[model samples]
Target: MANDDGMTYADAPLRLGRSLDIATNRYQVSGAIRSVGANASLPTDTTDVLLETGLPAVDADEVTVGDQLRIGGQTVATVETINAHATRDPNQHRVLVGLTLATISDGDTTRFGVTPVRRGNTLSLATDEYELDGRIQRVGTLEPPGTPTIRTVTLEISEVREDFAETFHAGMTERADDETIARVTNVDVEPSTLITTGDDGSVNVVDHPINRDVTLTTDLQVREATTGTTFKGRSLQQGSTVVLDLGTTTIEATVVNADA
Candidate 1:
């Protein structure tokens, strides 16, 4: 992209635009993408991207670090920093954003199941020809002396990993046990703990007070009425006890007055 000055420079090389097919809700911006490993002495899987775009003076504060950017296709990047270039160049009034590529898959020892892929979670990077499934190893930002007011955001992204290699299946039922079942009274009372299902289908077992009533069902799963986080059970005896195990968390509730 060319700066405001008549003099042109080939600094920002890669195209940084929203991939409507991958992330329709992504913010529209333009810049370049570069691999951080270009200067690496060792191998790594990550890349840094620079986004220099015009923003309204009023909404400049809206953009901040930690904001996610859909770099290209399903590959999402995290904002590392936002440079206004006020001190470096007084003329070029644009946002020099720094971004680091996000990872395709992560590991969590406490929980299992394909690292919990949500609907909107990135699956792979899409290109005009094909898609890429890679990992981001490192990311950072830098600024060299220039007149066009260009900020270099470096990233060490590795595409060596095969596309769609890692795979996992949700086998939480195999981890279920009998201890997760318990009995509690079903009344117009609030429970100390609650479990809810996120829009992405991820289970959220947190401590929140919620009221419940006696709506007996033959096959009752451990569920938080407020969030709809249902945990499958083995021996779900409705009138006797409730069995619910969400893998990450478990709850046992028994009705003191079963008929009530």
Candidate 2:
């Protein structure tokens, strides 16, 4: 990693883009692990590569203050602040990724990142960004919960979707009780996002909108005659999949008609 000669971090020996990897030495800040580097593409808002893995566990206790971390043989970042519920445990955790620069010398460097993992008193650092998701299988008759189930059979996809939101919605089957009732589950919605699936196979998404179809009807009744949400000549039914306006958003209903 090389920077212009004029710049300097005399106080902190760190910057971004400096090949920081797993097992790399780390500097601690606020009880969290962190490294400093310099990269033009790094814009704290939405970096293409988030060194913090997919999402941290939403466990407040798990995030140790004054802990150290690294990736790919190098130190990457330290836990600056945690912006989540402390008392409540969320399904996914988002950490604020900040490069630790004691001075300006560590800037303009290319480096790898590492994550801290602990299981039953065993703590190790990892150098991979991993995510959890799912696949689909076609199934029979619709009447699904809301989001389509992964199709288990052919010609009838179960409408597989990655559905993992919060834990409070774990055992709640309100959708199964009444088809007319509109229920919302806040969770991650794609294979890239973590989908909460128990052994029995249930799914829910976090903070997503329902049936925002330009071609589909707001009433959410699947029929050729239905006007608004008509995709592929058919209105959406429970457990059905339709490409919503170039496939930006996905809307799958559990039953054919919520009103029915």
Candidate 3:
């Protein structure tokens, strides 16, 4: 028998074997699981499972939090969050889905299904509720690895209102859900240059600067994840953009530097 994709049953074993090899080689660094099936069970004893997919950019938007995952008319899990990762193929982006599973059983498979959820194995899942074709990437607690630490990050705001920049001072904070996410420790503002191009294709900087370049040093909780250091759920790395809300105003700035 063959599936719509023209993949026959004979191809299953080869695909599964290849996926297992890929998973083993990339497990530690990539955190990718290519497939799962009956011969395997959950790698760890946990209710939280992380699924990975290489969904087309157009269809990726269909995944969201609170989406129900069902099999055979039985809802087995709920999507808690979605994280995207870039890949060499721009058309197909990789995504990680954090799932919270409810009680489920399939013979010896027990909580997950009839098969042991291994690192790499193709697992057929229902798509009636949420159209998803994912392989189990991880089976363990989804919480942050360890306690967060205070880190100082410097950001550069290319343009800002002069008045706002003057009034913005240290001790101001950005919060989410009433929890402080970042606190400004220092602020520096300077005249920003304006650039213009002539008809000859010559680039020039205007003599009179109209904008202010605001540099801010902020302290925030930085947590480590399997991927890397993260601040406010985003990759905390140089050249990344971060948005800070100071109650009265909001500012988006590019990270200039960060303390390791």
Q: Report every candidate's CA lDDT.
A: 0.33, 0.28, 0.66
Estimate the TM-score of every prediction: 0.22, 0.20, 0.49
Candidate 2: tens digits of C-alpha lDDT, residues 171-209: 222221123211222222222223466677878544324
Model 3 is weakest, by summed lDDT over 10 consecutive residues, at: 25-34
Better of 2 and 3 by TM-score: 3
lDDT tens digits by residue: candidate 3, 31-69: 223344546443433367677767775566567778777
Least well predicted 10-residue stretch by lDDT in candidate 2: 134-143
**Angstrom error at residue 181, model 1:** 62
Model 3 segments beyond 4 Å from truth?
1-46, 49-100, 105-138, 145-147, 195-208, 225-227
Per-model RMSD to reference: 25.1, 19.5, 11.8
TM-score of 2: 0.20
On TM-score, the leading prediction is 3
Q: With candidate 2 superimposed using the best TM-score fit, by how many Å does residue 173's alpha carbon deviate from the native?
A: 25
